[model samples]
Target: MEDIRIRYYSKTGNTKKIAEYIANELNLKALSIDQNDYNSPCGLLFLGGAPYANIMSSKLREYANNLIKENVKAVALFTTSNWSRRTVRALKKILREKNILVYDEFLYVHMLAVNGAIEKTKLFVKNILEKYKG
Candidate 1:
């Protein structure tokens, strides 16, 4: 099996936490978009970012747009937000336009200005993992 790649950009670390969970579950390396080399070989890709003012972090958005993979079989998207707004929806639209196959997507509610409750976040991540792993 090819390795899965998990990349994320986060300011408040909520998205980073979720990305870590996904990466750990998939046995992939969790890296920040700013720190990783995007040219690495991988079978799957997971992109995550925090929703900023109802939009994805500009850095993450640009990174996703600039990804130069020719045949990505599976892609997963995740974002953290204070409310259930259109953050993930916008990300999905962007990825669709880029012709990436988004297999699953999730939006997690995070407390504003804080890293959020770790216990709650863990539960949410567990639920997501269970759902996707099935």
Candidate 2:
């Protein structure tokens, strides 16, 4: 995984499931942002969270802010929402302020079936790989 880390905060388990799928598929470590040692790794970071009222959870925001003092090379974000980019923009603002490079974003809306979410995540992963592939 080369220091790639997947961290997420889930309120209803949906975001957690998405994070786990991405981590497992990519053979990387998946952890909760609340973990005691959830520091930004060196290579890449995948941060996920559930949006509430068009805003990211406080835990995610705090972690993003903390990245300013870390040495992470790049970051990507994934979220489970009902169709809003406000959360993404808000978090991007924080990362941008710290001059962190945001590679891409994935948004998986809450669906009744798991297949839809899984497929979307797979596509998101593919896109990320293609975008970052050099």
Candidate 3:
């Protein structure tokens, strides 16, 4: 598998939980946006966030905007929200604007109810791993 990095911006920890789960399965540390730097290259980047009123945080937008295509090859998005998958869509748009490939599929977890988050995340991660494992 190629080196993968997981980063997220979470206001209520719901997104964080999902990010952590993805990282744990891949044996990597889940990094908050504040902790992650874009100085290094990675094969795939898993970015997670939640939007308020369908508005993505400026910080997260900036991160997506500054993502160097040479450094981060591609992105897979995920979100945790009450009912909106807006963040995932927003991130995809931002990344694609810069010509970065955004995986067609994304993960979403209900913010208030994550009863099967791990299992769902496992399946998501499995598919991601398989795709990149080559």
Query: What are the TM-scores, per candidate, against the unseen true structure?
Result: 0.72, 0.84, 0.93
Tens digits of per-residue lDDT, candidate 3, 1-134, equal 44799999988788889999998898998999886487688889999899888798888988888887888877889998888998888889888987888888899898866656899999999887676665
CA-only RMSD, every prediction: 3.7, 2.2, 1.5
Candidate 1 residue-wise lDDT, 1-134, digit = tens: 34567788888677777777666565666789996455565556777777676777787777767665564545666667777546667767777887766655454555462344455545545664555456
* Model 1 spans > 4 angstroms off: 69-71, 107-109, 112-134
Q: Which ten residues in a row have the lowest lDDT in candidate 3?
A: 125-134
Say which candidate scores most in TM-score. 3
Q: Candidate 3 — what's its lDDT?
A: 0.86
Model 2 TM-score relative to the real fold: 0.84
Give the worst 10-residue stretch by lDDT in candidate 2. Answer: 106-115
TM-score of 1: 0.72
Query: Which pairs of residues clash in candidate 1, taking residues 3 or more apart in a chain or in different chains?
Result: none
Query: By the TM-score metric, which is better: model 1 or model 2?
Result: 2
Which order, best to worst by lDDT? 3, 2, 1
Clashing pairs in 3: none
